[model samples]
Target: MSPPRRSELEMRKELVRLRMEMQRQQLDYHAEPLRHPLRQLGHLFAPGRAARGKGTPLAFGGVLLLTLFGKRLGRFGKLARFALEVYPLVSAGLRQYRESRPPKPPQAPPKPQA
Candidate 1:
């Protein structure tokens, strides 16, 4: 077979480029309907957008409560009793630690320039 001319190679390249572009456009068109839903799903699962320091602890406590109470009430009662018993000692230790820390020196006012 004869070697292909430069013009023929260029034409083939242009045809491939146009075909690829058309396929890309078609893919975009077909995916248009999914864009919004996919975006919403992304936002729903995005860690950065999740609520921070808000009801997170409360939600966790709620789940914990449900799990504790769902299976057995005695376990929850025991946990509560343990927490109550430890509260006073924990508070006393914290109070002693705070009292032992040295107080910060007060800042002096800036001197006025002549």
Candidate 2:
């Protein structure tokens, strides 16, 4: 196969430069929303709608299986009880995350003295 010509290399470099400039412009355009006074103020308010009754079908099926097998196997009852105990922990972590402050950029690491 023939080697690429000098013009082809120049064209490729120009294409890459154009692509990078387009990305930079797009980022700046999208970032304008965060700079808006209304958007900054609105972020302070609580988010709308608490998540509830949003269980998957698998969860419902597990509950049904537990209820059905609880009498015959007894293990199902224990499994159900364990799940009940863990539910509060899962919800508490979720609630804490929902109410937590926005993440900040990481600070530079401290330089070691010579």
Q: In candidate 1, what are the lDDT values of residues 1-114, reduced to their tens digit?
A: 989667988999999999999999998975654565556346433665343212245444543554345335577756764664455466667878889999989999999999
Which candidate number maximizes TM-score?
2
Q: Model 2's lDDT to the true fold? A: 0.63
| Cα error of candidate 1 at position 80, Å | 0.6
Q: What is the TM-score of each candidate against the true structure?
A: 0.30, 0.34
lDDT of 2 by residue, 1-114 (tens): 999667988999999999999999998875665467466335323253124324445554654565445446577678785884466467667868877968788999999999
In the predicted model 2, the residue pairs found to clash are none
Q: Which candidate comes out best when scored by lDDT?
A: 2
After superposition on all C-alphas, the RMSD of every candidate to the true structure, in Å, is 21.2, 27.3
Candidate 2 residues lying further than 4 Å off, grouped into runs, are 1-53, 84-89, 104-114
Quantify how close model 2 is to the true structure by its C-alpha RMSD in Å: 27.3
